[model samples]
Target: MTSIKIEHVVHEKCRIGESPVWEEKEETLLFVDITGQKVCRWNPKTNQVVSVSVDAPIGSVALRKSGGYVVALGTRFASLNWEDHSTSTIATVDEDKPNNRFNDGKVDPQGRFFAGTMSQEIRPAVVERNQGSLFTLFANHSVVKNFDQVDISNGLDWSLDHKTFFYIDSLSYAVDAFDYDVNTAKISNRRHLYKLEKDEGIPDGMCTDAEGKLWVACYSGGRVIRIDPETGKRIQTVKFPVDNTTSCCFGGKDYSEMYVTTATNGMDEAKLAQQPQAGGIFKITGLGVNGIPPYSFAG
Candidate 1:
């Protein structure tokens, strides 16, 4: 196993930075801070950062094929205007409940947006139930599929060949895979590809490289684990100082760089003191295969 070292690329206060993507068209990295209610864009080539606030809490974001980006807000999905910072809701998940919210999501090769949900309970503690559901929004706006009864919905990605789908149920400590029917937009044949010990921090965000391998961020394990989904073997590990490394994405001209987003929202003072790099963005260069270009919102 190769020792992984984390390099802090940007140090900023992000309440909970989660989803990250490299927009090849724009040559920038875009991410969301759910609790911060904001979206940010960073240009590694120019070394600049630009951000904007959203009306509601945002969970995930992705570039659209049309020219803009799609966002997963508290209970709805919307399109974002990066230049003007304007967002318009396109789909609603739980409008009647108002207690549940969207969590993490990504787009598939077919330009369909796949998003998950989380508990909206106000008990000041994480609850396993009361979580939202998974939804798929087709470009035509006439087709919407709902997969319900979820708890802490997190990472998502598809195999390089687009024949399989991988996902994370953070609290379950398991990474699962399903046989994907692209034309029918259905997932079945569920099986476990990786399982973690309770103490290894929950698995949150994930992405697949061009090599068809899985790269997952360890919520509190303070590192990213590169695993071969088929064999369920750990191929590599990237360590971080903070225990709350949230999500990661591959972006760059050649998609060689892996950009990571971290968090500090649920940490106590002692933990925060132990890791000042908790909310910053980190990058690992010169390694791993590139990732498939993110699918854009079909406008």
Candidate 2:
């Protein structure tokens, strides 16, 4: 186990802060406030924050190789120009299932955009009958259905070798590993690599370090745990002040710093008062590790 220190860096009070990605080229962190329908950028060096509003709920965002960002907005995928806040639709998913919306996603090593959907009506007592699905969008604007009947499709990333694909279906309470073909961007041989106990909380988002350890954000657990994918054991744990810790990514010049996002969507006034930093971005340092550079969307 390693000791870590967590600090609150942003006080935006986002409704649903998620998708923390570090843009090394810009030397800043990018994230989305889903319910607020805004994309934000934070520069740690200057302590400056910039936000851009979108038309609909923005689930996740990925950097584009050319410039700007590719975002999953509500039921459609669009390209966003950060300068003018202008958006152009690229493709739409699950047009028939109005109850479903895009959730967590990332760009693959091959430069393909892979995002998943979830029911908008998620609750503790009510189980949503509307199943979610995952889709892959190519540079040519062609979309492919990868998997279906998914419940709250969440975190996703490839192993250090880019041969094993890891994904999380939050409702399933497990981290699944799949055989990945980088050349074709195809995944198969799916199997459960680790399952979490209910008390550990649900896994929301994840990323891999250069050493092949998987870092998972434990939603209700108020912590981020690093797991040994091959052994299915937790190697390190970094605690946060907020309970709804949503997602995390490594940033900074050396990638030693960790950025985390949390949510305040379902909290009432009392709960919000107890957790004032619920929706703020957190920074963790002294982990003594670095992460691989994030892949960008080629399209």
Candidate 3:
């Protein structure tokens, strides 16, 4: 195993920091503080951090090829102005389920935004209810329903070849692979590629490296584990200083650096005191791997 050093890069004290994305063109890292209702940009080169406040809880954001960003604000997909932080509605989702909100999402290789919703009530006992679902928003501002009955739709990425789509529904404790159509943005033939035990922790956000291996952040396990998608076995583990590791993405000049985001949402005062770095962003180097560039929304 290769040892790596993890350092805190941002100390925003976010309530729920998630959706870390690397913008290779600008050499900046973009992520969201869901409960804090803010979108943040961190530029390591200049050591600067900029935040834009949003009206509602923001689940995720994707760079737009057209000039700004496509954001998942609460239950609506909206266009966000990078300079003014103004948002215009593009489409709304899951309006019938008022208690549900968008959780985690990413842009596909073909330029479509994929996101999923989860129940806001946070009831772990009632896993039987299908309160969440997965969706895809295309360049035309059209939305499509992909799957239903999802408890907590989190983490999504596609293989290098764009043939397989990997996803996580946190409550299932498993990573699923689906047959994908890059041209049509359709997914099918779902199968479980990996399943984590109770002690291993539930999978949250994920990204694929150059080798096609998946690096998954464990929500309660306080670590990011690299898994070999082909065999569904663990390859490496990167432990963090906090217990609520939310998401991670590979960035840096050569895409060798891994940036991770953590949360302090459910921790008590005692627990928060123990993990002072919780809700901050972290960077990990010396992993001996590179990540593919993140895709931007075409519209």
Winning model by lDDT: 3
Encode model 1's per-residue lDDT on 35-138: one tens digit a residue: 88999998877788899999888989988887778999988889899888999988787766667778899999888889988876353227658456778878
TM-score of each: 0.94, 0.96, 0.96
| lDDT against true structure, model 1 | 0.83
lDDT of 1 at 54: 92
Which candidate order results from sorting by TM-score in descending order? 3, 2, 1
Stretches off by above 4 angstroms in model 1 are 1-5, 121-125, 128-130
lDDT score, candidate 3, position 165: 98
lDDT of 2 by residue, 1-299 (tens): 46777899988898889898899888999999987999999988889989999888888999999999999999888999998989999999999888887889899998999899887856521347437888888988789888888888889999988899999988888999999999988889989988887777988899999899999998888889899998988888888888988998989878888899998878889999999999999998888898888999998
Higher-lDDT candidate of 2 and 3: 3
Q: What is every candidate's alpha-carbon RMSD to the true fold?
A: 2.0, 1.6, 1.6
Better of 1 and 2 by lDDT: 2
